[model samples]
Structures are given as structure tokens and as C-alpha cells.
Target: MKFERSEENIGNRVFKGALFVAGGRFVLRLFSLVNLVVLGRLLAPEDYGVASLAIVVIGFMQVLSDMRVNSALIAMREIDERHIDTGFTINMLRGLLIAALLFIFAGPIADYMNEPKLEDVLRVISVVLIFDGARNPAFTMYQRNIDFSKEFRRRVAATILGSIAAIVFAVLTKSYWAIVAGTLFGRFTEAAFSYWKIPYKPRISFREWKVFVSFGGWLTLSGILSYFTQTIPQLLIGKYLGASPLGYFTIGRDVAQVATRELTGPLVVAITPGLSAIAHNTQRLRTAYRKAQAVILGIAMPIGVGTALMAKELIAVLVGAKWLPATDVIVWLGPTLAFTMIASATDGLAMAKMATRAMFNRALFVAVVSTPVFGLAIWQGDMITVVYALVFRMFLQTAVNMYFAKTLIGDSFFSPFTSSWRSLIAAAAMAAIVSAVPASFTPSDPEYVVLLEMMPRVLLGAAVYVLAHFVLWRLAGRPDGFETKMLEVSGIALGKLRRFRRTAN
Candidate 1:
């Protein structure tokens, strides 16, 4: 991982890689909004709840199969074709097994949930696991090479196609089947695009089987535990409270998750490869880890807080008033997801260091601690209680994981807080100003008119948040931060674009 003087521009490449990923996510969010808003209007909450439950089942199987082979591949100092072939062979086998399991057990799972319709949904969606398994494993090369532009294009196309499929299916059937169609189409596109985009072909080999398993075994365990921790609540809620309530819970969680999960997605994509590239240098690794957390929180914290404050208007405008029961769920989940993002981001640094044992232990602790909390929430049979349980679990998990990450990076526990406190303070100030505004935009008549009323409040809140954050950021003497780095990256990107245009001319 040592860089020669000629290769000292790694930092620049890292920034450029981040720009592509962030830009892709920016566009993908627009596609997701279209998917969510249109589908929300077309399908009932019960439809969404059923589809979501089915997805959770499929998702768990996929996670169980993910032995973290790709992550291991990226972390390695060098990986030959043998390693790649082994990873691919293992993946294909796992995919087939998971798909078969889904197909075979779909009926039993449906019976357990007491939703007979879910069996069909599970069988239909099981094909995605095969597509996922068959996808080219070479896409990690784009990440390892610090080139995300190609990855961005691949994702954007898939999202656009998937959103189109979802809308069309929703219009045609108006059943939960529409969501399943979109999910399947998206996975199939991603799997097909991988081989087309990369020069890799499927080949069966196990020459490096032990190498892959040794590195990925803990990752596989950790993935399974993490998925179960996150999804068990959805399962319990669907069983105990029924589909419509789970639908409301799911939608609310989705809206709140955008602030944390969606925003953090690209950051993780960029940073994991970047951090892996420099893992040999302890000092550099420490600095990168600290700065990354700061950047994520600086952007994510404000959005979470602001979204929490404006959940009512957001739900009314985006999701329609019939879904208003999810408002409280959104408020709590907004901050809950914020903490989860922080925890997940720190874990990425550990992954770069190959600290899977530590990572697994943390995941194990959270799973052990949170299972009862989720059970209690289900027992209470209230969506708000479920959200509160999640918030509490995330808060505890963040602290424990940060402690483990701190040990690896040799950084003090306070480093993240030092880098991130300004953003929190700024968000608080912005929230105060936005909250003081009159609550005059709530519509009393038709639900569709609520969208018109929500526009002004949303615009006002966004305007105030931006102005307040920037003013305070500057007044604090403008430390080296996400804003400064983003401007530098944008300048580099613009210069490159201009050069390309010149060459074209």
C-alpha cells in the first residue's frame, strides 16, 4: 500500500472517485423518489406491507450467501485470476442454493406469517438470487482502481429501468405484484450489466477456495447476524400487527432511511476502496477514517434532524394523507437511522483493516441485546414503540462499534465529535428557526391539495437550513471540512470536463 512519489496523487483520485459516487447517488435519489411517490399513490399500504415482507425474506437469503467475498477481494494486497474465479464459483453455488431454499420454503414462511399470498410473491422473487449470484464479480475492479464513473452509469441505468418497470406494473395490476416485478427487473439488469460492463466471464474454479473462506467466514457470520437484527422487527410486525400497519411502518422507515442509508451508500462505496488502498499506512488510515465520519455526519445529521422536524409535511406532500399514521414513526426513525449510518460508516474502516473479528463481535453484541427489545415492541403492538426500540438499539450499537473502531485506528473517542459538533449545532439552530414558522400549511380538504400546501413549508425549511448552516460554518472560521473538500473536488471535475470537451472539439 506504500505509494511512490509518482503515485502521491492517490488523494486526488479518491476525491474524484467520491464525486462520481455522490453524483450517482444524487441522481438515484431522484429515481427512488419517483418510484416511491408513484407506487405509494398506486398501491395500498397493505400491498406495500406484503411486498416488503416478501422482500425481507429474499434479502435475508442473499445476505446469508454474501460471504463478504468481494470485500475480502478488495482488501487483499493482490488478487489473481484464481481468486476471482473462486469467488465467482462460490457465489453462483450460493445463489442457486438460496433460490432453491426460497422456492421450497416459501409456503412454510407464508403460513408462519399467516399471509397465504406471500408464498406466490416469494416464489416469483426467488429468481433474483440466481441473477445476483451470476453477476460478474469483476465490478469490484472499478472500485479497486478508484474509478467509479462506470459504476455510476451501471447503477443509474438499472434504477431508471427498475423505476419504469415498477410504475408500469403498478398501473397494470395495482397489486403488491408490481413491487415484486420492479425488484426482480432491477436485480436482473444489474447482473446482466455487470458482465457487459466488465470484461470478466463466468468460470468455475476453487483453487483459492480456502483463501476465500478463511477471509470471508467471519464476514458471512456478521452479515447474517446484521440482516436478522434489522429484519426481525419487520417479520414480527407483519405477523403481530398485520400487513397494513407494517406497510405504514415500512414507508415511514423508507423516508427516514433516505437521510442516513441512501446518503451513506455512496460514501461507503467510495471510502471502502479508498481506505483499502491506503491500509498499510497507519497515520494516513487514521486521518482518512476520522475525516470520512466527519463528512458523513456533517451532511447526514442536518438532513435527519430537518427531516424529522418536517415529517408531517413530507408525508403529506410526498406520500398522501392516508399514510399519515406513519408520521411519528418517521420522526423517531429519522434520528435512529442517522446513528445507524455513523455506526455503519465506522465499520467500513474496520473492514478495510480486515478487522472482521471485531466487527463480528460488535454485530453479535447488538443482535444479542436488541432481540428482546424488538420482542417487547412487538408485544406492545405499537409502531411507535417499535421505532423507539430501534432508536435505542442504534444508539447503543454506535457507541460500541465506535469504541472498537477507535482501537484499530488509534484515535481518541472524541475525534468524531470534535469534527462533527458544528454540524449538529448548526442543525439545531436551523431546526429552531424552521419550527418557529407558522404551522399553516396543513390541508383540511382533499388529500391531493396537501401537496400544494407542503411546497412552501418545505422550500422555506430548506432555504433556512442552508443559509443558517453556511453562515454558521463560515463564522466558525471555516475549518478544513466536507464543504472545503467538496469544492476542491468539484473544481477538479470541472477542469477534467473542460479538457474532455476541448479534446472533442
Candidate 2:
């Protein structure tokens, strides 16, 4: 009975945490949509592309600097002030080193890409490295304690301020410098807030140097490999396709990443702490994995498919005809986006099991496979061909990552895929229905007409898909059963609350 009560408490906590993360993500995404729309119009594609070149180098260096130690700090059990301080000190040093390197390499990087203008942009963005590195490691303490309320506030504030700064600078200067400046400002603000909110100060001590380096070594390698897997395409494009075409490619990638990051990121952040808490309990780990997979797939598969189907209309309507070329890129990359989302969830499973070496090796494989494929595509000298290469590479990488994750978790590689197949099918049907309804409703004003026509189709499609999911779950004998379990858990939580209230009385 005590065990049952404890299980109920765990379920309740998980439910609440998931709700907060999901809600926060939705709000943040809305803000991001606004930011993208404003920036897309305000800046030229060439400007964005130039900024992208600089960002690629800055991003790679930043990843190497941080080394995922902040995540490791949250994952560790029995963390102390000493651990927090050590992680903080390491992050600060790494950030300073990275900033210095970026400043030194700025000219060379710009010259390699043959964009002399990018030199200044690279130098300016280097400031973010130091700022981001100096952010308090104690910020993860909130996450480690499952206090997402603070996390949400901190992120939203940073995003809002950042978006505003970017838009303002873009309007004032009409240059890529605006984007880079906004990013630096946002990072600085976020880092300052993190330190202010978290109650920890760093002392200059490398007392735990051996332990920190040992763990961070594997994490840093994983970070570098992951950076290569993600950024190699941008590098290849900037090298071969020049700025404008790279801009188009970057737009497609960013659109897909926005969905992937916003939808899956919060879940990743929320799940790690829970998984860490249950790392030793195989049964609990399995339970969490199953539910997390189901929830992520239920949403991600439909989103990816729908985005693919609606890419042309959506981009034409939202970003204007200037972005219509991104439509093909979006469709080609959609499945990759979905698979990557699933892979992210699986990454949590690997981390929970402390399989950093396995994770590193898988990432390395992806980087190796993706880089040459990207280079080949660049050699082909076509934007669409480059996107196709990305699609193929991402698909292969996702499969490999998923296999490694399943091996670590003692599950079949196909388990998540099989579970999600139904949802994917339902979403496809919904997309078809939505697409058909909008065909006959075209009007003279393309944007307004598209929005008006799409509104009802979207509503109907969402309703049908959700209803179908529930019906299918019921027919499979899982509907009421899952809900009943939840209710039972909630009832146990209420009973405990009542007991506490009575004691206080």
C-alpha cells in the first residue's frame, strides 16, 4: 500500500511537470513565430545568410566550451555546493577560452567564406560565449529540484527581450549586425538573470578537477560530434552555394528546428530530472520511456507530416512569396524533423543510463556520415540536392541514435516506431482532408484568403485526428485503463493532501 501510494505521488509529479513544460513551450513558440515573421521581412536573405555563416562558427565553438556539464550537473545524484561551484568555474573558463578563440579566428573564418563583412559579426557574437559560460550552474539546481516555474519565467523573459532587441536593431540598421547584436544582448541578459535568481556563487577552486574533467571529457567529445552533425550542412553550403542560397537552406532548417526545438525541448528538459531520479529502477525507467515516447510521437509525427503537406501554403501565406522556395526544402526535411524529435527523447534515455560513451560514438557516426554527404550535395551545386542530402543523412542518424538508445534501455529498436504508427496514419488522413477543403476556397488576397480558408480546415483536422486517436486507443483496450490509472493516482494524491490539511487543522 505504501509502495502504491509512492507510485501515485510519482505519477502526479510527472503529470504536473509535463503540463508546465508543455504550456510554457506553447507560449514561447507563439513568441518565436512573431519574431520570425518580423525578422524575415525586415532583413534580406543575403543578410541572414551572412549572419548564418558567422553563427555556424560561433555555435560550434560555444558547444565545445560548455561541454554539457550543466546537464551533467542536473543528472548527478547527491549534488552539493561544491559540485555546483566546480561546474560553474569550469563553464566560466571554457566560455572565456571560446570567446578568445572566436575573436582570434573571426578574420580567418570570414576570409574562408569570402565574406569580409562576417568578420565583425563573428567578433561581436563572441561576447555571447563568455556571457553564456558565466551563467550560474545553480540555474540547473531549479531543474534538478523539478522547479520548472522558475525555469519558464527565466526563458520567457530572455526570449521576449531578445526578440524585441533583434527586431529593433534590424529596423534601425537594416543589416545582419542587428541579428548578431540582439543575440548577444539576449544571452547577456539571460546569464545575468540566471546568476541573480540562483543562490550560488562561484569560488576559484579546481578541487574536483579530476572528476569534472573525466565526465566532461566524454561530454565535450559528444558535444563536438553533435555540432558537426548539425552544422556541417551550413558549412558546406556557405563554402559552395554562396550566401543567398545558404539563406534559403537556413530558413528551411530553422523552420523545422523551431518546431523540433520548441515541441521536444521542454520535454527533454523535464524528463531528464525524472529519469535521473528513477535511473536505478528499471521498471520505473521503462514506464517513463513508454509514456514519454507515446506523448512525443502522438504530437511530433502529426506536426511533421502536417508541416510537410502544408509547407507551401503556410510559407507562402506567413512569410510571403519570397519564401516559397523554402516549401520544397520543408517537405523534404519533414520526416527528418520528426525522426530527430524521437531521437531526442531517446537521448534522455541514454543519458539516464549514463551511457555517455555510447552516445558519443553514435554522434560521431552521424557526424562522419553527414559531413561527406553534405559535401557531396554541395559539390552537386543545387539547393534542392543539398536539402535531399540533409534529409537522407538525418534519417540515417535518427535510426542509429534510436538503436543505441533502445540497446541501452533494453527495448526493441522498433518499439517507439510501432507505437507511433497509428498516430502517423491518422495525422496523414487529417492532412489530406484539410488539404482538400482549402482547394475550393481561394480568394484574391492570398494571405488573408489563405488564412481564412485554412482556419476551418485546421480546426476540423485537429478535431478529427484527436477523436480518432482516442477512439483507437479505446478499441485497443487502453483508453479507460490509462485514465483509470491516472484517476487512481490523483485520488491518492488528494487523500494525502487532505491528511496534511487535517494535521494542520
Compare the candidates by TM-score and give the number of the best one: 1
Residue 377, candidate 1: C-alpha displacement in angstroms: 1.5
**Candidate 2 overall Cα lDDT vs. reference?**
0.73
- Highest-lDDT candidate: 1
Global local distance difference test of model 1: 0.80
lDDT of 1 by residue, 60-99 (tens): 9888878877787777877777777898999999999999
TM-score of each: 0.93, 0.90
Candidate 2 structure quality by residue, lDDT tens digits, 114-183: 8888888888888988998888877777666565777677777777787788888888988887788778
RMSD of each: 3.1, 4.9
Candidate 2 clash figure, as a count: 0
| lDDT measured at residue 139 in model 2 versus the true structure, 0 to 100 | 76
lDDT for 61 (candidate 2): 87
Worst 10 residues of 2 by lDDT: 1-10
